[model samples]
Target: MSSDVIVIGGGIAGLATAHELIRSGASVTILERSRCGLEASWAGAGILSPLLPWDYPQSVARLAQLSNSLFPEFIEALTTETGIDPEYQASGMLVLPELLPESSGDAKGLRQDARNQMAEDWCGRNAFPMTRVRSREIARALARDQEAFWLPGVCQVRNPRLLQALIRAVNLAGGKIVEHTAVAGLRVERGRTQSISTSQGDEYSADHYIVAAGPWSRQLLGEHALKLDIWPVRGQILLFKAQPGLLDTILLQEWDYFYLIPRHDGHILAGSTLEEAGFDKSPTTEARQILLAKAHALVPALTEETVSGHWAGLRPGSPANIPVIDRHPSISNLYLNSGHYRYGVTMAPGSARLLSNIILDKPQPVDVTPYQWPR
Candidate 1:
């Protein structure tokens, strides 16, 4: 097989994996159902941190930490290979928790405040930099006057440009990307993948096969999908064209996971709702109304008039937002690298490194137990 490996899906996970494999001197090809990066990889706000890292399991945080550590060098390599800048920036994040006075009898509000305190403790133990500041101290445009947690080390990359760079880099590194080629099924003979069949009456043969199809991983795998819990989580985002520097930091609402991320070009993205609406990627009017109201409440500059775009992306929702980055137990040469519920972009490099290491039999930088296949 000239194409040593076949990657099913061309989103961040697949592209990053292909890039990693090529870097390791492996021949690789990516098969995408549509144009690359037009899905969740492009639609995301590109926050590099696990939202409230303290709230997630240790495995999630560890993987995220590894990825964050790799981002700088990874972005530099992509930019050098392709003349496109992914706009990777340490934009920081401000987490605003709704606090209640001690005199208030609201039990839910008290629990919320307690969690904020717990988050502070977690940050301390993890050696993650965090500071307490009034909302106005950082990103003075917030409409409310409240204290917030600021993680100055949090970073973000422009998801679309990053994908473009990755695609170009992969091509430069002798990797093939077959777009618009949806896989029909895998030809498994004697616990090994012999070839992959496609919907276009095409078949591809590779020494190894990886399924990184994001939310559609299970659908693509069919009966081959093991005890996988990957499902589509519909998330809608509202884009606002605002003045430059209107909001400098990523603002996250602790009560709900609603967030506002501002690009360098004054485009602020406000999202999103975690609705288990199946595989539907349609943006609902109700989501728009709710997001708009939240955006306006946070920054007075954002309103219905300033709203420029509304879009939706289906995330690969999983248990505890953990992803599977291991090989299939039944199939010897088949692997999976999907189900990164929310931090797909954030976990791209680390997950890619981990998966590629598994395939190459290279030493791992972290324990690979948490990302193992489910049975």
Candidate 2:
């Protein structure tokens, strides 16, 4: 099928791009190897902001900031259109740093504390309110022995529901989605993609193409030898069903690099190991144990609840953990919008908005030079 824009991959990036393009009066079609919105888009913990914003580079922070700002309106519109609540919550994040005794405020101890203090300073500089408070003030679920900082502006979404809403939004916007259809090969001619040859032995052509295939994006590009820095990093998460109000805020332990996320419906999610397992999405027992131990450490009451679910998804890891969201350097008609890694859900709206703007030659909101393909 021919269209104005053929988005390769039916994840949030592709669907959001298609939705924006359709709203701009462009005909769009999305091709997915499996069902849409079930990959990293669905499997993510859906913390709508970077787990630690100060830890990322400015390029990553810029897109994340814009996307975070855009999410409320975006999700609200999607909810209104699709009749699905994505469970968008400004639940805030409670970051627990290693506890240092008040008497021994040495340089090393202060250094560990400085990470949180730095994040608080960054939030203040950016006009976002962040407070360092005693651990017992927020929730009884956390370890009272630790020191914590609260970033109330940090939010989360139900990723699976968000994906469902996106799929419905795309459908409502008159965007065509072809599921269970893989692009076997790209037929490029004279430095341009003429059409994509599918596994079903059919050819689909479009005026322009976007590769937003997540973890598979780099592989697909390598199959066609297109230059894009994206690779698979496997992430595993554990879900525990607890009673409501068991956790009122998102709990983060920076020293351990693990988190406990509370859902509206009595489900708490403890995630994730960033493994370079080469497209393997298997959840290992080792990872499960590690996450479970961390979850219990964060909330002692969590040990009472049975594990509801554990799953893994491959994130598209990129160089410097920044996404490439610009036109392909060689192919004028091809655009790259993959390599979002852990921040896929956090950055989707801005990434899509940027890609759509680039496609339509509209003025961009932020500087695109940092996100461009390195020449």
Candidate 3:
């Protein structure tokens, strides 16, 4: 059997891509090994931007910027069509840098004040909403010495709900999804993929093939004589239950790479530890302790909150953390939309739009050179 496009992987990328493809008058089919949207798409924190965009490369920043702009209308349309809210909220982010440089005259070691100034200048230049607030003013839970600032433009979504909405949107748009269907390998002849062989010995083909299988995409490509620097970077996150409004914004400890995201109705999410543990989604006690300690450090009152849950997911990592959003260099009909690492949820809509446009040969809204095949 075949369709206009066969999307391998049913996570956000696949679902969103199929949704867009269907809208563009293309028949779409998605194949998922387990369930769609249950991997990184469901487990992610869903912060709409990187915790600190300044730390990312130009490509990542550009994609995120474009995606963030599209989110408002995207969410609105999805909700209107599918009747799912996705819990989208501009909850904002508060950054608290705990570590400061020593009094050494080394230019490389930036002092606390200098770091704050640099962040402020960057936000100002970018026109992002930011404000410096005394620790005591923002949260009575923090220690006296804790310094923090607010990025009021930062936003978050409930990732599971977002995935649910995407799935509904795809189905309503006449996209076909085959669950528990694993693609064993692709049959490539000459320079184009002819068909995909499944674990159950079923063969499927399409006009074009897309590998959005997340971290597993690397193995899938390798089976076809293609090598991509994509791997699974494990991240563990802990959830806590607290009263709504107990925490005003997303609390982040900058130097520690940990964050506390607040949801409506007394739900708080704290995460995460990035480990290069090969495809292992096991939760570790040591990581839980580290996350709890960071959460308590930021909001001492959180110590009284009940520990709710802990889980891990694999993010599709790539070189320099830039996602591969281009067609396979060798295979004419094989395209890729994976290796988004930690920002898959944030980048899903933009990725889908871009991939669909590329497939349909439409003018892209953003420059495509930086995200081309990593060579």
Candidate 4:
């Protein structure tokens, strides 16, 4: 089959890109190796904020912020069109005290002072404050006080629902999705991608092609001689069935690199362990135990609830933790939208829109120079 644009992968990045291409009057087809939206996109705890850019470069921060701003309208239009709620909530995030380990006597006071200084610096620069706190005080405050200053503009999305909505919206918008069809190689000739070979022995052609295959992006672009340098970082998360009002906001324990997300339903999702164990999606008991211990320590109430589920997903991690979202240097017709690392779901809409604009030769809503392909 031939189309104006063929997008590989059916996760948020691919689906969003295909959807935007269709909106631009392009005939698009998305091919997924397995099921659509069941990879990193599905496994994400959708935290849509630019707050984690403390160590990221300015280029990444720009895209993340732009994407974060576009989410409101994107979710609204998606829900309106698909009749499926993505559950976009603005519950905010709280940094718990326990994540910041205590130091000794005078050293402890000095460390606290440094933390306060760091918080002040961030607040002055309009960044989220990363500091130390008293875990017990934090627990008591969250449990008893509803009028705390922790509730800000932090937002979240139900990833599964969002993916479903995107799939439905894509289909409704006249975009086609093919599952269990992996692109083995790209047929490039004279510096442009003309066709793609699939594992099922079928050849597909398109006017334009986009590689949004997430962690497997490099595998699909093998024939094109494009070296993406993308690797998979495995992350495992745990789910617990809890009461609705147990935790009102997303909790981040900075030092522990752990987060707790409360869903619309009475469930709390806590995670995750980042391991560089290439493409493995198996959740380890060690990770589960660690997450459970942390969760229980943070919110003692969670001890009463049973562990509902544990799963793992591979994130397409790049060296700099930013996505590659530009046209291939040698192949003019081939575009890349992979390597989003841990923020694929959060950055999908903006990345998709930017890529579509670049493909259509239209003015991008945000700058795209930072996301240009490496030469």
Candidate 3, residues 149-171, lDDT tens digits: the string is 88888989999999999889888
Model 4 per-residue lDDT tens digits across residues 1-375: 898998999988999898878877898999899989999999988888643455467777677777878899999989999999999998777664332233454776577556545555654575543333343333452433221124256789999999999999899999988999998887778988879998999999988999998988887677553556788999999999987767677887655668888887878899888899987899998999999998887777776356899999999988687788998888889999988887888788889989998889989877788777765
- In the predicted model 2, the residue pairs found to clash are none
Per-residue alpha-carbon lDDT of model 2 for 1-375, expressed as tens digits?
A: 799999999988888888878889999999999899988888899898877788888888889989988898898889999999999989998888876667868996868866766887888777767887777787777757556888888999998898899888888888899999998878889989999988999999999999888888777876453556688999999999999899878988777668888998899999889999997898999998988888887788777356899999989898878998989888889888888888988999999899999999999999999888756
**Top-down lDDT ranking:** 1, 2, 3, 4
The runs of at least 3 residues in candidate 2 whose Cα sits more than 4 Å from the true structure, single-residue gaps closed, are 101-105, 223-227
Instruction: Please name the candidate that would achieve the greatest TM-score relative to the true structure.
Output: 1
User: How many residue pairs clash in all the candidates, one count each?
Assistant: 0, 0, 0, 0
Relative to the unseen true structure, what is the Cα RMSD of model 3?
Answer: 2.0
**Deviating ranges (above 4 Å) for candidate 1:** 101-110
Give the root-mean-square deviation of each candidate in angstroms: 1.3, 1.6, 2.0, 3.1
**What are the models' TM-scores?**
0.97, 0.96, 0.94, 0.91
Question: Residue 369 of model 2: what lDDT?
Answer: 92
RMSD of 4: 3.1
Evaluated at residue 102, the lDDT of candidate 3 is 65
Cα lDDT for residue 227, candidate 2: 56
Cα lDDT tens digits, model 1, 217-238, are 9988888887888999988999
